[model samples]
Target: MKNGKSPGSDNIPVEIVKVGRHRVIELLRIAFNKCLEEQTIPEIWNCAIVILLHKKEGTGEKAGSDHVRKTNEWLRHQSKVTDVIKRVARLKWEWVGHMARKTDTWSKRLLEWRPWGEKRPRGRPQMRWDDDIRQIAGTRWLQVAQSRDEWRSLKEAYTQVVETG
Candidate 1:
């Protein structure tokens, strides 16, 4: 729904939709209702197009020159694009720290809640939400997060580590 984003597999740009907002909304509404009634979605809706743009340095280099072709990793390193996983991890850490500081919120309660009747079915225990935090701030991460100043420092350290790593 956001403008300036790449079009989906349908190749319909958001700008076009915006131009015909009322008609588009009505058409989409009918389509959604029909899909729900039939319990079926259009096949094209499941398709996506992923396009990766070359970085400035990567683009300037000749395709068939003597110079070595830059790998995707090298190009990503040189580009300003942020890593999605790193950003998500940083956001998750910040959210966990924020929730940890709350006294009696549902969010905090749910965050600390554990399932009652789960049995092991794997070779190793799955990684947890607070695992990274525990690794960085020790077992007392929640206690550390309680203090505003301490939590801010911890967040900065976490951000630096995520960005670099």
Candidate 2:
């Protein structure tokens, strides 16, 4: 793993990590098992990056939002993008519970606590992380997460519901 090009949170290159697969497996098993025993994964793992491509029309011109939406609709009607998105969203939902429980940072606190006095412009309200979770998992997600087993079991099905609907 260490010799490879990719780097993870520990900053150890993959080339270094690949030196001893057994050692890596043992270390990961121990770390992951500890998290499982504690019923909470660490906050560091609960993140993802979203990149949007500039979609083009049939004529090769850049499409506006409306045209992009139509293209996406057609693509979705023809293939499995919807299912793939649901899977990604399910994984994301699995992290929200763990993230909600963390309080060691100001940014995390702001996201989870959602303190008052912030006003939005007169147009669309900014989408908060909590709002996305709620739309997928429902208003009682925090309560649901209290039972780790139930939360894990429902994550897949719930995200599918949110995605398809």
Candidate 3:
């Protein structure tokens, strides 16, 4: 319903509906009734506008396709694909933490393993999977993820972060 938002497959912007909700509802009712009688959804519903984005690094700007922006502009404003990616990432981290807590020899070894005495190259150290996990889930994530309900709630928190930030 925000201004300057692009229309979906329906080609109807939320602003139009916002200004004339009753009339829009009536028109939608007719269209939906016809669709129901024909037992077919509109092909427009499947349409998505693809936009290409150029790569721009070190500018602190998001450089990618417009899918994320378009998804955030929907009528219902559902979560974008990035949110799913974040949720999956958090779940994988939780799974790893859960496995690390296991009493098995392999799990214990993995939890305690470290690289030999080798000097790292200059500049920023190479990013590790554990670093990304800690960045998203915090240092106490392992303890929080131990409980099923707590992990689920943590995932929800991550979901909100993904959606808003």
Which regions in candidate 2 have their CA more than 4 angstroms from the true location?
1-83, 103-108
- Poorly placed runs, candidate 1 (over 4 Å): 1-79, 116-118, 159-165
Global local distance difference test of model 3: 0.62
Error of 3 at 159 (Å): 4.2
**lDDT (tens digit, per residue) of candidate 1 on 9-124:** 67889999899977876676667656655658889777766668554444445674544567755744644334555666667777887899888989988977888998877688
Work out the TM-score per prediction.
Answer: 0.49, 0.41, 0.42
* Candidate 3 residue-wise lDDT, 125-161, digit = tens: 8877666556666876566556777666666565455
Model 3 TM-score, 2 decimals: 0.42
RMSD to native, candidate 2: 13.7
Number of the top TM-score candidate? 1
lDDT pick, better of 2 and 3? 2
What are the per-residue Cα lDDT tens digits for candidate 2 across 1-165? 124466755677776666776677667766765664465778877774445766445543355333434566574454322345565677677677676555577744664575579876798888765676676557887776767887788787777666775
True-vs-predicted CA distance for residue 103, candidate 3, Å: 1.6
Query: How big is the positional error of residue 15 in model 2, measured in Å on the Cα after superposition?
Result: 38
Runs in model 3 lying further than 4 Å from the true structure: 1-69, 72-83, 159-165
Ten consecutive residues with minimal summed lDDT in candidate 1?
75-84
